[model samples]
Target: MVHRMRLMMRIGRSFVSILFTAMLASPAIAQTYTVQAGDSLWKIAEKTKAHDVTVHQMIAAIHENNSALLGADIGNIKPGMELAIPSQTAASNASSKHATQLLSGTGSPFSTPTRNTRIDSIQKKISHIENEIEDTIEALTTSQDSFDAMVTP
Candidate 1:
């Protein structure tokens, strides 16, 4: 039982360290592009094809990243609107991540699931950490009680 508790504590610490590292290593600062007059999403994607991704993929990524600014109708973007353009590698990774979540039955069916998916994942992690903390507290209380009983005699 003691060994198991030690292992659990170690795992918890490792998980926290990894989570912190990932937070620090957030995706590189996204490049921002300002919409120009008479420019369509397709045109922007084509002109900014710095990565190997297809025009469709680039447009989807740009829309996903800037959904808040683009609003419900991405096609209605106006001139001077700045959009965050994610790298192709980042876009590809996000696409694959979404696919994996869908395959695992944990993804939303909506076209834009990036924000929701991240929130769900973070919530799940928080729940798991809460459970682990409760377990650790119980174990520590039990150990303290055992020590007290032995000393009182």
Candidate 2:
């Protein structure tokens, strides 16, 4: 009888473990958000605090998860447009992918210099201007001193 009871206890423990594991593996359910009169993607994202996702990430997720419903330009979503908010993980992944693509792809036409390069260039221009100003001031000072000497009795 003791052996049968031990087996039953083991089975119960296994069942509980299985249930717990299933719960953990379950995916987060996606939610739907309807656009309000003055609702923007950012506003909606801010309102829906799903796992602390950012507005940009939320916008990307909405665009990707509901491409058919939202259309290509997620920015052009009108009032009363219903959007499907993705799970946190899914939204994060989609946002990351979108950002990567934007950076890698031809998003901007004009080429921008690196931060360091731009700073260095600005510093150089400032240095040149300062040198020119100093030269002008020195020339003016010398001219004034000479003029005063010539004028003195």
Candidate 3:
């Protein structure tokens, strides 16, 4: 029963993979965005129709060009303001990826790759130390038993 279930899943996955690959590889679909008045950063992001969250980066870029817009007042967005929507290309994807990576407590986003490497290294060291400790305690117990036996005799 489980074997059949696994087989079905594999077939379904391959079918979907081929379908989507053919879809994306074909002509690119053009997306359109209309600017409306009084739209806030959060509002624009919510409307972008992108699968991934891109509102924060869009808001960041908007503010970069116009620093005066960064005030705490969220009620002041003018109507019909033109804001450029960012593409989810490799450049923008990095920011989103980094943002997500941060939420899981792996490490700093911009840290040297060495930091990530060291985390794995530390984990390996901890596992090795635990194994060594277990072995040492077993050895100590055997030696203690032998000493007790000798003393008793």
Candidate 1 local lDDT, 67-147, one digit each (tens): 788654445567999888888776654554543433233555434334434455577689999999999999999999999
Clashing residue pairs in candidate 2 are none
TM-score of 3: 0.30
TM of each candidate vs. truth: 0.43, 0.48, 0.30
Candidate 2 Cα errors over 4 Å, as ranges: 1-15, 21-28, 96-153
Q: Which prediction has the highest TM-score against the true structure?
A: 2
For model 3, residues 33-121, the per-residue Cα lDDT tens digits are 44564454445555762565365454443333333543333233456654445555522443544433322324543223234333544
lDDT of model 3 at position 58: 45
lDDT of each: 0.68, 0.66, 0.53
Candidate 3 backbone collisions, by pair: 37-79, 37-80, 38-78, 38-79
The best-first sequence of candidates by TM-score reads 2, 1, 3
Runs in model 3 deviating more than 4 A are 1-18, 49-54, 61-84, 88-153
On the 0 to 100 scale, the lDDT of residue 137 in model 3 is 100
- Superposed Cα deviation of residue 48, candidate 3 (Å): 2.2
Candidate 3, residue 128: how far the Cα is off, in Å: 47
Worst 10 residues of 2 by lDDT: 102-111
